[model samples]
Target: MTDVFETDDPETDAGATVLEVRFTGDEGRLDRALALALPDLSRARLQALIAAGAVSLDEAPVRQGSAAARAGLYRVAVPPPESADPEPEPIPLTVLFEDAHLIVVDKPAGMPVHPSHGHARGTLVNALLHHCAGSLSGVGGVARPGIVHRLDKDTSGVMVAAKSDAAHAGLSALFARHDIDRSYIALTRGAPHPRAGRVETRLGRSTADRKKMAVLRNGGREAITDYATLRVFGPDGRPLAAEVRSTLHTGRTHQIRVHMAHLGAPLLGDPVYGSGGVSPVVREAVAASGLTGQALHAAVLGFVHPVTGEALRFESAPPPAMQALAAALSAL
Candidate 1:
């Protein structure tokens, strides 16, 4: 749907305009409210604009965390126009493996693997588009040309994209069979009593929060996470580190994060999961490490070659922050 703000003149380079709007419907999202008033942009773009502090209500910047507005007369302000031309930034990427069939990339945290919503360009896909040129195979959509699977925008990990339809089919089958080996390294608040275990639960969308996933028994799909304790310690000792290697029998949204939180060991810096209760030591360590998102990294990926049928394995070391956390935990 179109966003809440629009201008009569698209070419107008006017600095900013004040728009008066009246809220309708039940207490609606601020974005929705704005989009209703401004219909030219997409909802995702509006949210990004809001997050970027480009949208102001009644001359005040709208806070992204604030509750939605009820019936009201609101004055909305729009930011200056952005450049229409998109330039590909030469962002560094870790190449795990590359072949005629597909390419496996060890994506870093905070990088969107592909273009979506407000992130239309300068994504990993865009980079691949430039790097691979005519080599990338066309998938179902125009935006996602070679994409097979996806990692979340903030979750850094190894991901595979096909170069041809045959490769895509083969990789899809392997994924369907749960043959792809995916391993992640994560730091948690407290150590589990057993130190190693498996979590099998049904996961579904949270009824209260649309942005989050929750473990549900009634109607959720089954999800599983196999975890091993890489290291364990008390408060005076080291912080706990866990190696969670998950094979998705069924890929539910946020499966690992939700299941881990259900086990009371949410990943560090996961704002949606209470930050794992943030111990003083952990908090201090995390702050010192300069991590802005969850302390999770995809460490290993393995699968049979789509065309060659040869077993292949790719591994990536944790990013700097994750490595520092590991070092601190080791000393503890």
Candidate 2:
């Protein structure tokens, strides 16, 4: 049941394929037809081949933008593979579930999903590479094997990574369509006013700052977050912190953090979206509990297995820090 498809391209010494594909389909356009027939070959690469006269129809070079009028045999020449090389590091991983097609991990806070500008090592990808032993998904491309969705460096909990190209493509599509169920637990400074509601907005890169994202009024992706205050606690029966449970309808960067902050309940230790000042009551509790960093955990992740016709749901409890903080909050 794996979503993966393989072309019978003749293999080569360098492990690359010089694909020569021929097919007959309804008359429409090369771009449209090729994409439908071969979901794996990238559109950009297909268009590149057509423009360079690597594709032909009835022995005539098909224009890159040609619109076919009828079903006919079309031939294409696909390029060979390029070497994939990424350094694998023996970093530890907290695996939740593993199978031939994918791996579900209980990712800890402070580990980035992949290498980035400021983080070059100690990432989940580096660790996964070493653990998979070369059996990670390649559909992610650029040597970013097995990576699908990501959590912020400060967020910890249940996550899934694809172990094959087909699984990668299928999972990626699932995330894009918002067909997966994902929930998070967050410790916000103040309780949401209504206690339970949904926040919907258009989100994009911040115009004021390139390094951050903002809820824009125009020209941005749609974002929606549903949140409910699980409980509110403080010292001496005074409200100090609220445990909020949130579900995502759209997966935008910092969507929950931004929406919660916009609603006037910023998360504690959120250096970016949090209120710069902390309430004295919560501050004292944090100090005593030794809690630091954003108190967000990906508590629940559920999805249909791409390679199997089965429903899969995984849950992880908050890490020690979050549990300790919550325990302290209950006492106070």
Candidate 3:
């Protein structure tokens, strides 16, 4: 259950972090083993680096899709950390609050938080770069310089970014401790069985679709979601859809949407999870609201101030599309 590694030695050639790992664990994928052996690097980042052919085992190149990394010594060559300073663009940003340490912004739907493979421009980070005027922090490395957490590209609501490394660390710890208060409002097909309840599931990459997440049976990470039915819309006296508010105890990708879908109540307009066969009323509401993505909104966020040691809470009204959807539902 322990990984013995020697990686602090200087690189033999140019910029490299030569790592010699004798993994003692017999479980998990090679990427998982590497990620566990090197806790400093994020699992996702380690997977990316491994997939990029940056590692070797026993003088043989370690394939990114290698079956597993067993109890064996391996050599890993880590290249120099990539720079995160993407070009700053004049992307509009909605600042909700700001100070020397951190800034809160109301991020719009359809805007990615940071740049990655397909999305190289017009991200929130790009806007922050332009607006912060060289004050952006670099503690989070290249993938996410000041990003503490993220919302999906189609979800709109409050998001906070760090201005200083201290704030970034504090916020990251808060998230790790699950001390931050977060709430999301969503419109889902059908009412939940209990009207309000907790959903505890082990989440992992879906076997059916690698791009999506699923409640897995084995070797998955723990995920917890709590939701309550706020209102129900069933114009013809049959339950069609409901407006629900959810609190996340653990943040996994698409946790709420996946859990709700697992409850047989997929969020309205969710292209990935939805069955595309909702009742006429729900369909009409979703279509008329101008929502081309999931009908979910991050409505409330609360946490302690990283610098000032003060409690803070912020609330945001649903976006226009959600507002329209709510109005349509209420009228039914």
Candidate 4:
């Protein structure tokens, strides 16, 4: 049965009337309360609103840093009008391979992989939902039906989605065991020493900024990235382009960017972990290719079919930006 709640009376514009909500003793957190009461909004966005003094309890403003509320009867104020609609927008996608068990898509950069705070619609998942016509498997959840893994919003590449529960389980297991073969192509500022090597580091949340991840010695997970320089040259023999392929033994947040930066080579357009801006030569080359964001792509993905047990491999060419960069480097 769908969860239901009474809406605040429309007569009062002090916002909606205060609706008294009695916690069941277990689900009393402000975030949980808002989630239960307002099922339409995402948990992250609701939490942000609560943190920003937009949500009050019993007319008393709740502290942003406060933990979940204890079991009690509290009045929650209705939120203000939203400035933007989170409705899904239809977008085109490139399908590399599709079957009853899975789908491999050539995801584009700048398009979010899933719906999130500012990106409520026009996501890869939303487009898939529309294109697949409700045929996607409900393995993860209603919101994330066939999702098994995710790529960052700005990262473009080949991603797979399970079309059935069995496929979902099988794919999840493969990823957990590091059995899937995943390869990425990246354009960094400088060539790596030795031209080919592996980087092993422990990564954890940054102490200085909770929002960022960093390589940490004491408290972090082990991350392994094996990279080989595919090509290295410069516009005037000054060392401009470095094309490297990275294979992840252990996936960690910002592993490639962090490890690359650690090796004195950072991704060209990464704003957070590496250099924030792009070089003039790199910018001109990338613009010719008509692409924005970082020059990274999931060029290869390989795995066994969940049902047939047959080996399957998929590869995608670099997007325009990456291609343009390659051509410019070739001339150099």
Instruction: State which candidate has the highest lDDT.
Output: 3
After TM-score superposition, what is the CA distance of residue 6 in candidate 4 from its true location, in Å? 18
Model 4: per-residue lDDT, tens digit, 1-332? 11234557554356554445555555545676667666776667667766666555545767652467655555445545533423334678899888888898999888887776656677887888877777777877766778888888878899999888899999999988889899999988877776789998889898999888888989799899999988886742446768889998876777887888788778777777666445677667766766566678889999998888989999998877778778876775
- TM agreement with the true structure for every prediction: 0.78, 0.72, 0.74, 0.73
Model 1 ranges off by over 4 Å? 1-89, 235-248
lDDT of each: 0.70, 0.80, 0.84, 0.75
TM-score of 4: 0.73
**Over the stretch 1-332, how does candidate 2's per-residue lDDT look in tens digits?**
01222344443234434443355435466676676666787777777777877666656778765565245555665655433456789998999899999999999998988876446678888899999988998877765678888999989999999998878988998999999999999988877777899998999999988778888999889999999999888642446788999999999999998888888788887888885767776777666665567889999999999989579999999988888778877776
Better of 1 and 2 by TM-score: 1
The residue-by-residue lDDT of candidate 3 on 118-190, one tens digit each, is 5777888889988998677798776567899999988999999999999999999999988999999998888
Query: How accurate locally is residue 35 in candidate 4, as Cα lDDT from 0 to 100?
Result: 70
> Which portions of model 4 miss their true places by more than 4 Å?
1-89, 235-238, 276-279, 286-289
Ten-residue stretch with the least lDDT total in model 2: 1-10
Q: What's the lDDT for residue 26 in model 1?
A: 59
If the candidates were sorted by their TM-score against the true structure, best first, what order would they fall in? 1, 3, 4, 2
Query: Which parts of model 3 have CA positions greater than 4 angstroms off?
Result: 1-84, 235-237
Whole-model lDDT, candidate 2?
A: 0.80
Q: Rank the candidates by lDDT, best first.
A: 3, 2, 4, 1
RMSD of each: 5.1, 15.2, 9.7, 8.1
